[model samples]
Target: MIVVDGHCDVLWRLWEDPERSFSDGTLQAGAERLAAGNVRAQVFALFVPPQVPRGQRLKAALAMVDRWHGEVVENAGFRPLLWRDDVPRVTGGDRPWALLALEGAEALEGELVHLRVLYHLGLRMVGLTWNEANEAADGCGEARGGGLTRFGRSLVEEINRLSLLLDVAHLSERGFWEAAEHYDGPLVASHANCRAVHDHPRNLTDDQLRAIAESGGVVGLTFVPAFLTGGEATRDDVRRHLEHAESVAGEDHVAFGSDFDGIDRVVAGLEHAACYAEWADYLLRYYPASSVEKWLAGNWLRVLAARLPARPMTNL
Candidate 1:
């Protein structure tokens, strides 16, 4: 089966340490590990940490995008999916595909044009906020629990106009609802779990999961141990989140986000990208092959095909 992981911080890691090789095994999403896991496509997130000054966030994001082009694009066995049509080419070939995603809108610096600039740079997915309030919206970490601002709603409209995937992974409850209400395009919680299974701010509530399902989007069940439970997390812990998410979101809306390098602590047996097949075997025991196939990659592919623009956008 072709596996498509929804989120990883490998680009941020590479930007942090320029000498780190993509083939390095210590990283959760090393190129070798991805190959071993049979991952057909992996979403690389451009995550600007909150500490970066607002003025410099855009530059930081561009630098990571440069690193992606400089390093990953040069790799022989990898291809970057710049448009929806690029998906089939990569999936049908022997090489692995890389999809660009913005983990937070801080990089946009409250300007809608910056979103267009990033889109030109090959960004296909965007998340409005990371863990705190930005100019666009309040995040899960915000104490006030506010929703999308006027600018945030406008950004959602622009994202729809551009035909990019809108990710609601770290939005506050109100912000999520705001986007859900306005944006009729493809939506995804790139790296979130079920709050019903584990009560964490990052985990989506059952209602949130159902909203994603009803929209024909997928909830990528992540591997964050803390989001899985208060105690140490194991493969079974991952199973619990998946089971609960499937119950609420239905099998078609559930998939693997992994959160690989983005997460600090790892699940016991499913530590890195290379171990995905092992987890797949475990999931197979409980779910039928067809359901497991959807969880592995089909669901994400379906969303991408539906949401991505048919023709690439030109200079405006």
Candidate 2:
């Protein structure tokens, strides 16, 4: 079966350490690791940290996008997926594929034009915030707990117009609902877990999970240790959150996000991208092969086919 990780920070990692190659073995998402993990397709997020001064945020995001094209997409074993039709090519072959995602709107700098440009540059997904407030909305880490702004609503409309994947992994609770109010079709919490299980701000509440399910969306069970346990996390923690998400959202909405290169600490049995193969084995003890197949790649494929634009978008 093919494995599709809904989220990772390899570009962010490569961007941070300029000398490192995308295939560098030291990196968690290095070429060797991804090959060993057998992760046939992966989502690489362009995450501009909140502290980046407003003036330079766009440049920072663009640089990562450049690396995505230069490094990840240019690699021999990887292919970039920019259309709904591209899904079959990746899953049907041995070569790994990639989808681009923005972890926060801070990179857009309050401009819808930039959103279009990013989409044109192969950005298939957009996450509104990354743990701090931006023009779009308050992130989960924001104490004020506000919802989407007028600009945020417009951003959602633009995302809809472009047929981009909407991610709510770090939005504040109120912000999540407000965005949901205006955005039709499915949404992906690309790298979030169940708050009902771990109680982290990054995790989605049962209501949020159900909302995703009701909309025919998918939720990636992240491997962030702090979100899983008070200390080091294990595959069992992943199982618990997966089971909880399945219970509330039903099986269709559940899948793996991994949050691999983005995080510092690691889950005990899941140390890097390659470990996904092992994690899949751990999951099999508790689930049937068919169900495990969906959690690994099939469910995410379902979302891609339904959410991606049928042809190259020209609405702008």
Candidate 3:
């Protein structure tokens, strides 16, 4: 299967530790492991934590992007999945394709010019906040639970105007709705589960799921234990979350985002990218081949086809 993970934290992990190998088994979404899993197209998130000093946050994010370009791309031989047409290059190929993503807009520092710089550097996806308030919007974990700020509303317009992917994975409920209202184009919750299933604040409500579907977007079911079950989470928890997401968002709007390397705890039997093939097998018993195909890769492919710009901004 030509699997595509909407989010992973390999870039941030690599930036944090310069000595690690991009293809080694140490990281959950290591290049070699993803190849084993047939995850041909992977989105590596350049995550800058809110804990990073305000001025240095963008520097940290840029450093991760540098790791992505200088290390992973060079050592792993992964092609950049720049345009929708670029998808076919990784189909059954020996090497996987890499798509750069920003997990939090703090790196942008409330400036659209930096967004253009990242876009020029091959950043295709952007998430507004991590777990706290930023100039863009409030995160789910923020106690105040505020919506998108005035700057955030403008950011949405700029993201849409530039034809970049907007991810609402960690946004507050009000921010999500506001972003949806501002962005009529496809927007994904790149690494989120169903809140109705586990009741985690990070997970999306059924209403949010439907809203994503309504906007022609996908919801990536992450493999975090806390978001899966109160007790020990296993492959079955993944199945249950997928079932709930499919029930709420329909098969067309559900896909996988491992959140690998970014997460401290992973579901049992789903330790790394290589384990996704096994997860796909388990899902087959519950869903049809076609639906399973969508969940594993097709849904994400559909979103990219619709959202990615037809031509590259070579002049910029």
| Prediction-by-prediction clash tally | 0, 0, 0
Shift in Å, residue 285, candidate 1 = 1.4
Model 2 over residues 214-314: C-alpha lDDT tens digits? Answer: 98999998889988875788888888999999999999999989888888899998999888888788888889999999999989999998898776457
Kindly indicate the candidate among 1 and 3 with the higher lDDT: 1
Model 1: CA > 4 A from native? 313-316
Clashing pairs in 2: none
**In lDDT terms, how accurate is model 1?**
0.89
Superposed Cα deviation of residue 133, candidate 2 (Å): 0.3
Cand. 2 Cα-lDDT? 0.89
Candidate 1's residue-wise lDDT over 255-312, tens digit each?
A: 9899888778889988899898887898888889999999999999989988977763
> Which whole-number lDDT from 0 to 100 does residue 252 have in model 3?
95
**Pairs with steric clashes in candidate 3:** none
- Consecutive 10-residue window with the lowest summed lDDT within model 3: 84-93
User: Which tens-of-lDDT digit does each residue in 45-155 have in candidate 3?
Assistant: 988876788789778988888888876788788888778677656566577789999887899998988999999889998898898889999999899999999989998
